[model samples]
Target: MPRGRPAGVPPIGSYTAVGDSFTEGVGDPGPGGWIGWADRLAALLADRHAEHAPPGSFRYANLAVRGRLLDRIVAEQVPRAVELAPELVTFCAGGNDILRPSGDPDLLAERFEQAVAALRAVVPTVMVCTGFDTRGVPVLGLLRGKIATYNAHIRAVADRYDCPVLDLWSLRAMRDRRAWSEDRLHLSTEGHVRVALRAAQVLGLTPPADPDQPWPPQARPLRSQVRRDNIHWAREHLVPWIGRRLRGESSGDDVLPKRPELVPLELPGAVEA
Candidate 1:
């Protein structure tokens, strides 16, 4: 069954996905472009729930906006999410905070905590938070360090709020340069599928029927053009580890595992860059 819908709820269970471009599936084609992982996650959840849950027990709403910041989410998205009163709420945010010139890690964490707290007040069942993908950006050369700091903040917030988090930053895909788009920011189709699969495993839903299928036929040429160096990164480093966490097979570590080789590129004369 799909991930978010509660077992025994009506087939049309409601959900609200709040996040940035990654959640919006920015590069993906059409409205359903692989641009946002949230849509893919929603689809996976619905499809699986349809199959596994008794008839008519899955539905969701994607409220993710492109380029959204943590502050903006509190100002706009959270109120709507409260009104939706979804059975499940997934929060995928923080990339923009890391990208903005004036982004503050402390403020980002505070807002995230507030957002989760607000969401929980409305929907108590499931609240999923996502971390960043710190690979391939020239400006974000300190991506790994920044992500570690930010994820630490997120983990703290999750523990305080009693929510689940999906650590996309430490995933092997973020370490491998090939998993990123040519722009060196957004995810490629393969990256989207990997994220969806991971989310499925987390939500306890069946994996996509064909996990290897590319979203658009045109993406095939793009896929070929990019090197597939980190193709096994997700399977090797992320999947098994996160699978254990989701299944309650292991205790999750508060500190993110290190991948120094995957660290962001350093700029000359930059502090810890």
Candidate 2:
């Protein structure tokens, strides 16, 4: 890769993403499955590669399985990604660890730093992301301070390695409730679209258009309605999450990466299985 700013669009010969559900496209539902920001960005990279490189030159791999912690990502996915040696690598993990009540934010950051360092050591261009604010969340709101602290460490680590950062904390668009799914834990499809565009900008690629436009005001629900919805959400999403935690299970326990190999990205409208 070149040192200075890219002449025009940077050529992404290939891309490999590793992390938890965020990178796995959990919230953003697709016809085949979830297509998160990583896949969106890969499509963009593929378009660029088509213009500058050979047809089908751009390859992509996603080793991210949902519910993975920093150590799990480093232990399981990092080595495989390093072996693939893609031109671009996006690593977004440690969010799940930060959400845990028992984990130490500082220690988690240390582990996150190691993962970033290891990836940077092998991959030419490494990208990382910070956790978003949790003020709007119910039980998770208490961890706002911790999330901020962890984000600071993420920025520091990226600075240390001169890696590109997708600063999710700085994205004010995410503050809107519309940016998240009903569960409030993962991003909505629109949110993933915005993130993908921002990540492309960080990598010096021009997105077709911005997805961060302000959302219009929505009608407020009644207090009773809000309470009922919260209760339902707790029963459906929260309880299951807790049950999994108690049993040491993960949503990705039996899941595999949707795309495990570096292959040519389909066109925007094409479906993935």
Candidate 3:
């Protein structure tokens, strides 16, 4: 554990990730159904802490569900995480809320701060995340203002609790079209890798590679192709998302956490950034 941690807080080794689709590995598929940045970051943390702990002792859990509301995360996931009391907790919420038509950043910030304060009380480290810079995303780009407002509050909450911020908004690599999946919502495989690399850096661990590595040069798609792709995207992804919202349904309606417990984590080519 680093020096000056609250006296009773546990040492750093175990980690728990909390949030929605982003942390749940929506866009990045792997050995399992999805392997998001949290899993990748866990592999890096395990490798770095290996010498200091027994084999298989570095544990990790991800309590994120897709399309979850920030209040639900606080009401359900937060308490469970507190019970587990892992040395490190990455509290990422509010993105789903920011997307709602009636989302209020200031109100969400109050709730977010409460969760962070509670987690910080028992966990040696509590990391927070900001929403992505949605300027280049399709429909989401229109709500960039809402996301930005939420991001600002997130930074303030992290600062108040002395927690580190995974400033996704500042990651310039995300602006590229290649960073997202066909839905133009969740990240693509490359996007998850970039996020993981950035997260490792945020945790003060040496990243295996650069988060902002340049993509190979390629010709832009034809204007006609862009129009077809947009139409296809609306039918396949966007329309369904809107329907779900209208019906008050979610992609993760009853989905369980990918990794519900802080057990030993298996390291494989699963997280080669």
Candidate 4:
């Protein structure tokens, strides 16, 4: 783990994040990777600590790699993260696996399971698994089915581990074609902010105050894409969802109430839910 505040540096809860590109702020542009969800989540956690009058502050390290698969995360990121001994750890992966034409469902499941097991061995961490985005790919025809299978597998793995899972798959914004970047894989700046806010909510972090006015001067694509408003949706919705689960709110496969219909594709490992 990286060094924290001096012994006198005020004890803030520590957080560490690991996974692939989404975790890396692949398309976000800003200091502290603020464009990415992980950074936004960290900020929210820190703000929450501030509101509470304090036992400590919030510290975070993001070690996500671009294009990283679960196997690589297990072999590489986890070891380094364990050193941080974080109080909270969030992971966003499986997009690459689902995108691969030949990726195996069982293999993906096995790798995800191993990653979770390895993390658990290190710390009593709160693990978060983000769902995949199926709308933006050029090869959506080949990748759609696999994405759903991977998400279901992720849910299963979360259940097995008794960890909280944020159902990003059900976020209404993700299904909208206009909500993506030009690459069709990455989120637009606005999308990234939305994702960040949502993840914060999932983690039970307080949202930042809204801007005095509506954001984004205009609906331009590459230039005016990022919107900071309502970015806290996740904090409002997902955070409570996680808290309920932690408080023993309910069990028995708590899938989100409404989800987008799975787009059918002829891919291996694809299964109907």
Which predicted model would earn the best lDDT?
3
- Candidate 1 lDDT (Cα, 0 to 1): 0.59
Candidate 2 TM-score to native: 0.93
lDDT scores in order: 0.59, 0.84, 0.86, 0.58
Lowest-sum lDDT 10-residue window in model 4: 264-273
Provide the RMSD of all predictions against the true structure, rounded to 1 decimal. 15.4, 2.8, 3.1, 16.6
Give lDDT tens digits, candidate 2, residues 1-273.
212226664687989999999999889987778898898888877877788778887899999999988888899999889888898899998988887887788999888888888888879889888888888779989899999998899889988998888888878889887888988899888888889888888888767766567888899899999899999999999999999999988888888887888787764563211
Check candidate 3 and list the clashing pairs: none
- Score every model by TM-score: 0.67, 0.93, 0.94, 0.67
lDDT of 1 by residue, 73-154 (tens): 6777777788878767778777667755576777788877888888899786545555555455444666667777888888
Report the C-alpha displacement of residue 87, candidate 1, in angstroms. Answer: 1.2
RMSD of 2: 2.8
Candidate 4 residues lying further than 4 Å off, grouped into runs, are 1-12, 31-34, 53-56, 133-137, 206-273
Deviation (Å) of 259 in candidate 1: 36
Identify the superior model by lDDT, candidate 1 or candidate 3.
Answer: 3
- Per-residue lDDT tens digits for candidate 4, residues 104-148, read 876888887877877777656556665655665434645667777
User: Which stretches of model 1 miss by more than 4 angstroms?
Assistant: 1-12, 31-35, 52-57, 133-137, 209-273
